[model samples]
Target: MSDPAARLGLGLAAIARPAYITSGRSGDLGDERGVGTLRARTRELLDAGYAAGIRYLDVARSYGRAEEFLAGWLADHPEVDDVEIGSKWGYRYVGGWRMDAATHEIKDHSLQAFTEQYALTHELIGDRLAVYHVHSATVDTGVLDDARVHRAMAHLRDEGIRVGISTSGPAQGDAVRRALEVRVDGEPLFTSFQSTWNPLEPSAGPALAEAADAGARVIVKEVFANGRLAPGGGDGTDGARAAADLAERAGVPLDRLAVAAALARPWARRVLLGPVSVAQLASNVAGAELVLPSGVDDELAALAEPPERYWATRSARSWS
Candidate 1:
């Protein structure tokens, strides 16, 4: 039972890059070249994470060779039991490793697949994994009531492993929320859900609220709006402006204010900011140390209302 509050800056402490989880297919990310150096890189990143107070790490089979690299680091590493790992299943890969060329895709959420996948990854990342999130359809598709998906995930939880789904967007969030409301197995079958919550596409609001009200864990990805929230090209300019006004009133920076606004959501457990550098990671973690004053926080909240339109017609979202 790791401290949830500590896990607050807790989960997915911004990953240091050229470890882009968003890109693949062209780059030899998991090839011999990448694998040779990845473990050391991960160790460096983990050291930085510890310094920054991040206790949870999220990885998946498809995230290049991330898990295998981590597996190497945590094997006899002193930090083995210090952090939490939340990995996923569903997308089958070639070889046991994610780097190999695709033999085929299982694409099935069967209980057998889930259990087997979990065992495969679990065998690699045991004490490191504190949670298991089914990685649902993420490539321009949505998750439905796939019974196999449900049963396999439930199987994981029944074994005492915390199970959940890291949904893609509003569509999946809607499904997950519905499942929770109905209490599939006398209670919400899943303990957590990962989705979007950014100024660009704030569509996660309704479902997020529902899950929160139900006391389900709401882990957010793309909180920085895929780095658009940073002050550049005025990408999140409108959101940033609204955030700035909120920050001014609250006496905080836009980034800190933005993440704090997310924390304001009673159900949001953590915001994942997968940064590409140590500097970027620091900015995100610094957000948690900030406690906005009431007057300022209130002002920031109001500013979010008027300019919601600016971010609407935008595309080319970044989930990294």
Candidate 2:
């Protein structure tokens, strides 16, 4: 066996198993049970991921019918319990968006709503949940410090759930910093921080590193730059070459290189990926075992240098 945490160098290469196999109204992957092709094809991906030792499972309430799909899948297949399942709350899905809005963008973080949403998990997801989040990705400077949300989260933690926040969007790093600064009776606010991190988007690096120094665990999302930075894929040609060359040199696939790069970063405590199929999952875990060619990062960083959209300037300057 490997160190799991250490071999990832940065952390383990976790198969993200995206809640959304396809985009949904909530900005998360809507469920795919209706997708006839997916229904028949993904059992291999799940089996392969578990065989490859991926131990973390991530999904959210607003991610289409993800929880329902997971429940159905796991119920039919009881062999997939070795991994930890983490889900998020604090948001709702309606009107083609997944933001928190009780009535026209107010953003519900009330202890009442939070608890209601939390309980919904057991109903839709059964009792396999291993971690929970405050849905930090939906929060901003406007509501990061709310008492109702924080209090309910604290209550959940005291009850023995591994509570954390899911931060996405521009000011994600700042959100991580703020989440880190929060404390209860002098104790830290969160145990883990999930953010968008990849070679193309290092926006979370500063905060992630700071959190690492502060002894907080880090779980990285967007390890593949939302699937653009992976092998044989991308909207532009920017870092593709560097990624390909490095992938070859490392004797690993491009997507694996992307994931391995994340896992290898000191501040990165976990690498979460979204594998649409089982082969992809197997390929990802195998790639994690590859050691990058010397200085491949320099090439990657160079190719990844050109400024672009969210994928390039990963920094979240939008929170204000």
**Predictions in order: lDDT:** 0.58, 0.62
Candidate with the greatest lDDT versus the true structure: 2
lDDT of 2 by residue, 1-320 (tens): 26552233111112222222122212222343243434434445555556666666677765544565566667788876666778877666442322232231223556776778888887977668767876764444444577656766777677667777778665677788888877765666577777777776676788889988988777887777655566655545455556666677767778878877877787876787676655556676766776767887776666544334663343321110
Per-candidate clashes, comma-separated: 4, 6
State residue 267's C-alpha deviation in candidate 1, in Å. Answer: 1.1
- TM-score to native of every candidate shown: 0.72, 0.77
List per-candidate RMSD values in Å. 5.8, 6.1
Judge candidate 2 against the unseen true structure and give its global Cα lDDT, from 0 to 1: 0.62
Mind giving the per-residue lDDT tens digits that candidate 1 earns over 1-320? 24323535332222322223232212323333344555565566666666776776777765555677677767757654667678877666443333333332346555666677788788888755768877764424333355666666666677777777776543555656655643346656777777666554556667777876877777777665544455331344555556545545655556665666666666677766564345556666777766666565455444442223533423342322
Evaluated against the true structure, the overall lDDT of model 1 is: 0.58
Off-target runs (Cα >4 Å) in candidate 1 are 1-39, 91-116, 136-144, 181-187, 233-253, 293-320
Best by TM-score: 2
